[model samples]
Target: MLQVNNIEVIYMNIIQVLRGVSLEVGDGKIIALLGANGAGKTTTLKAISGLLKTEEGEVTDGSIVFDGKRIDRYGPVEIAATGITQVMEGRRVLGHLSVEENLMVFAHNRKDRKEVKGDIEKVFEYFPKIKTLRRQTSGYLSGGEQQMMVIGRGLMARPKLMLLDEPSLGLAPLLVQEIYEIIRRINAEQKMAILLVEQNARAALGIADYGYVMENGRVVLSGAADMLKGNEDVQEFYMGLSVAGSKKSYREFKHYRRKKKWVT
Candidate 1:
């Protein structure tokens, strides 16, 4: 459903971030982009969603195509209308609005006015924890609730392709599990294509059909999710598991860097 071919993203016409990064999200398939902080995972999403232009970032090299249409030069609104919605990392929500109101905001552009309420109910179904809090001020919700609300809001747009950036950030382990399960269900039931950017390698790979490892703005590795899960380097670096299958501390390998073998 989406393709990013050798795209390089530059900010303010000077600072280059992405260097020949390319990946794909197949129809109704979950693709995971795994990397640590500052690996340009989020920037890739912005480029695909056309949110890069908002930060004075441009895809100066290569192209981004969605549903076979070239969208590298498109603006955020135009890209969104083409069935892409980015649920950004920060779990952003409107402080003053109620949870339902926050969700309703995304549907304003929809012509299906009557069905909007039904869609709200569908979102509630996916996130039953937020149903009771629908009329409550969103700012007062807990962090997990806020995260659920934001994902639900993105669902309001009924996007075909959802770019999820760091969805598990700052949440408890159990809450992370819950949200990831919901994301998996959303993909299976809605047949929505998802490009997931995450530092939590285990959770992302668990549901991903395929995966890519990024470093310093380039793809260092790419493989089927199961293959990545069993990889020694991936186990050591991302999962904190040693070759002996023992859990190791990040401090034990702080300076370790994987030898890059870029997928061609």
Candidate 2:
């Protein structure tokens, strides 16, 4: 249960990133926020996570409520303590820390030490590579492994709602699929609600129960993921083309190249 009221996030008074943004996440459903770069996806996540001090960005307009509690006013640590965790973009792992140590850092703050240890084992079970590299420094992990470690560390918190930002970014297609599959498993098996923010609209929509399309700052479309997936406008604009069985096609290839230009 997460509700983002008509919230506006402003930066430096000159820049406004999220404009009257509103959405909901029901129990066990994966809700996706799809948009291009600078579309306020990350800003929305930051606002929800309390990382963007509300007084600074100032949800000057609306409120965000989670698990029946008004959370828009709380700070990042407070939000995390309330069972909302964010695995931020770019896999922000502590490079100097060992894999196990990184997990232990989060676990130390949790309520149940025995359960935390059990969850650590469960995370390792989910990503065996992390277990194998327990003694290795995080800097040595591959991109996909780093992503797994970040997700695992978030799991250590036993969050009721997880805000995942671009879990598929920088990974190969196969790894992207692996990551999404794990997200699906977490929702299906663990019954965790998720607010997934991804530029990879196709993959995101494919797995999400519901989807929201955002542009510039506002939500342009919101509906069932299946409907958005079939909508021609979504395909031409946000999703581009289907990359089902084959490699990114000629048109898709060109679209990817053009997108990379802007992203870089």
Q: Which one is best on TM-score? A: 1
What TM-score goes with each of the models?
A: 0.95, 0.90
User: How many residue pairs in model 2 have overlapping backbones?
Assistant: 0
RMSD for each model, in Å, please? 2.4, 4.5
How does residue 30 of candidate 1 score in lDDT?
96
Off by over 4 Å in 2: 242-264
The model with the greatest lDDT is 1
lDDT of 1 by residue, 195-249 (tens): 9999999999999999999989999899999999998888877898877667765
